[model samples]
Target: MITISVCMIVKNEEKVLERCLKSLKPIADEFIIIDTGSSDKTKQIALKYTDKVYNYEWQNDFSHARNYSFSKASKDYIYTADADEVIDDTNIERFVKLKKAMLPEVEIVQMKYTNQLQYGTTYNYETEYRPKLFKRVREFMWINPIHETVNLEPVIYNSDIEIIHMPVMSHANRDFKQIQKVIQSNIRLSKKLFIMYAKELFIAGEDKDFLEAKQYFQNAIENETRGLDEIKAAQCVLTKCARLMKDHNLLLKNSLKNFADNKPSAEVCFELGEYFFEEQDYVEAAIWYYNAAFETECELNIHYAGDYPLKQLANIYQLLGNKELEEEYNRLFSKWELPKSPDA
Candidate 1:
């Protein structure tokens, strides 16, 4: 079996650190923790897990701290975890089995990162698989300070091992402060980073900063190489801009454009239908809404894409005072099994 070293860089995460460590300590051959100026009991908790805790000065660069943590891995393979992340017991078993069967040539392994589900009361956490494991000999390095990404050449091996991220607490002002740092540092924000930074600004409710982000997003889209995902991202930002600026016409235009290119995404069609419905253009709105109700395969959408159209059709029929049509639409809506939204 190949030995695996779990390395993590954390600071002031006293509430979450112990739980994360307790979940994986038994499985990991070595536990290396790098503390970046913690003013809490983070280091104390880490000491209980392993003797490999080291202090790293805060440089406002996550990658730098992470790379330092990576350097401390002495095992054949290196795994990374956040102070708030934990692998479930099932995944732990799989990881142990995979470690036993690992081949020397495997350079990297991608594990699923599951985020909290806020879509419904049931809250089914969804997992996104990403590269998190690496061969120590591969000399893998992390890039970027905030939103750091590992550079994986060729292809990274994919695995079903999943990790759960549970944030116990966070610095509420982190986004605005971080963006201010990036902007003030005179660092050139790349297309990718600029979009991410803009999102942070929007969520922080910094309108002025969001405007600055909008300009950056527009510039990024104009100068980008026009990849599939990039176009979708650009469209999303443009739609957000239209919504923020309250230009309903612009929103409709972007939505139509998105539908024309991408396979009528649920969001795009819904927005378009919403605009038309608000304008009381019943015919067009019904058509778009119906398209939205049938386009995507997302489980959360459940029968929403199917049921929404029927429900809206019922509403429209009622509004038109067509009793028979309304009853027919209602019957159709009632016949199918529909999935409820977070509120529903």
Candidate 2:
């Protein structure tokens, strides 16, 4: 069986640290815990599992901490995990079997990350594949009989093992601060970071959070090189920010940009619903809410297309004294389930 080193970076994770370490103890050959300024018993709990626990100064960057922890690993493979993650007995058995059967050429192992929507994190899906295991060292090989060429792509294996994520609290507030720091540093956000920032805003950002992100997204809209999807995401953020700040002109400008594509995002539709609803235009609000629930796909926060607008439509109908329609929408709202990822 391939030896595995469990590497983790934590800060003040006293509550869940022991539970996480105990669950992983059976499968892990060694634990490399790098504490980043924990004021709690997190380090004490980590030391009980392994003597490899070390302190690293808190840097705002996660990659630096993660890299430091990985550097401490002295095994064939590295299994990176968080304090909020737990592997059940059944999956533990599966993990052991995977270690024994792992191919030498596989450089990365992906496992299912579940329980994402419990705290309404940035992710859209309840479960998705995330790379958890990595080979300590990669071996390059030449391929093809006639025209030999070095294979540069890492051989990835998707495993059935699922890691349960049970965070004690949502990290959205902390994440927003980190994102704002990056924006304030005058660093350009990559496309992935840009989308993630937008998703986080839609999922859990407050009015102040949106306000902080306004300038960056506005700049993104005027960049001219950003793709349609990025532009749409920027528009969605700006639209929400405008509504919150009560800037009607900004709201209309961004919302119109969304409508110019002929297919509006459910987020914008829901925002318009709320705007009209606030103005006591129940009929207009119902139209937009209907569009949010049925006429458009959501770019972020599936609730906009699911329970959110359905509940709104139900309330609107109740206010309009349409009992039959109100009952129908309420029933739909009650039955709404999170939509599966397209690939799922």
Candidate 3:
């Protein structure tokens, strides 16, 4: 029966703030919100929940705002969430039970943030573990200007409680150009930063930016030292970039290199299927695609790593005039997301 404070920093989150607050209200003992210069009714909506609302001048650094919000928390445990995020009804009971059963030594509680579920949605998503719930200790401070992280002990306890994040609005980085400025000034020098740069480029959707992104990912892979996740993420990006760049040799090289590893990483199976398909090797390509659709697990940078391959297989079978295989995969893919009934 420990008290938990829900701490959050928000700006112009009016659209989804009410929904987020309502869902968290029953679970959290106290609400501590820091407004970062919202022109909208976000603050007005927040005040309905608690009087603990405080104002801070908008800072480009997210960690600053997050740290400041957590500082105001008076509870034993601090849980963080975004306006675009919600703890769904299915997990609410489990969440409360977990909170009640929490022990003293639990420094960080890692919950799955399902950015995208099932697949075939308007937006991309994957299940990622985030330390949203943590003990209210000063040592677990957040870091970084962008993609901020809290340094926590390796003793992370995974919780079954889940959170769904679907952005109701877009706050496209006003700081993208500034990040580029800092990168150019040599203020940031690291493989992580290069990965971030490549990510930004991948999001930009330009032909030239894709090529530049490939180079940045290449740099990350070459310079990184034994950071396996970072290297795998870079390879994930590079494999796709090679495909887009139409460099078949590079694609095969990287995909095979990925497959050569003891365990196949994210999107490698799908990429191999794509590579073989492009080489006009239909049988092998079908085998790879079938493996992707049914067998291997993926945590790829792409959203819907599970469903995307099945959809691709469905299309490939359609092109090959294999209606039996096409319909089977199409059924598998459609089972993920079904359109809502207008009346329901």
- The lDDT values for all models are 0.69, 0.92, 0.72
Select the stronger candidate by lDDT from 1 and 3. 3
Cα lDDT tens digits for candidate 1, 255-307:
67666754655545654666667678888977776776666532223333666
Please, what is the TM-score per model?
A: 0.69, 0.96, 0.67
* Candidate with maximal TM-score: 2
| Tens-place lDDT digits, model 3, residues 1-344 | 87899999988899899999999998889999999899999999999999999999865567788989988999988999888888888888989898789877787888877764432122233666668888886455677899999866445688888888877533324434545455556554455555555444433335555564565567657863637766766776777778777787878777777767666654667767777788877777777777765565553434225567778788888888999989998998888653332221
Candidate 3, RMSD to the unseen true structure: 8.2
Measured by lDDT, the strongest candidate is: 2
Model 3 residue runs over 4 Å out of place are 26-30, 57-59, 87-105, 109-130, 138-166, 169-212, 224-226, 262-266, 275-291, 294-306, 323-344
Better structure of 2 and 3 per lDDT = 2
For model 1, give the 10-residue run with minimal summed lDDT: 116-125
| Candidate 3 lowest-lDDT run of ten | 116-125
For all the candidates, what are their Cα RMSDs to the real structure?
A: 8.0, 1.4, 8.2
Q: Compared with the true structure, what per-residue lDDT tens digits does model 2 show for residues 174-265?
A: 99988889888887888888988899999988888899899989888999999888898999999988878878999999999999989899
What does the lDDT come to for candidate 3? 0.72
Candidate 2 error regions (>4 Å): none
Give candidate 2's total backbone clashes: 0
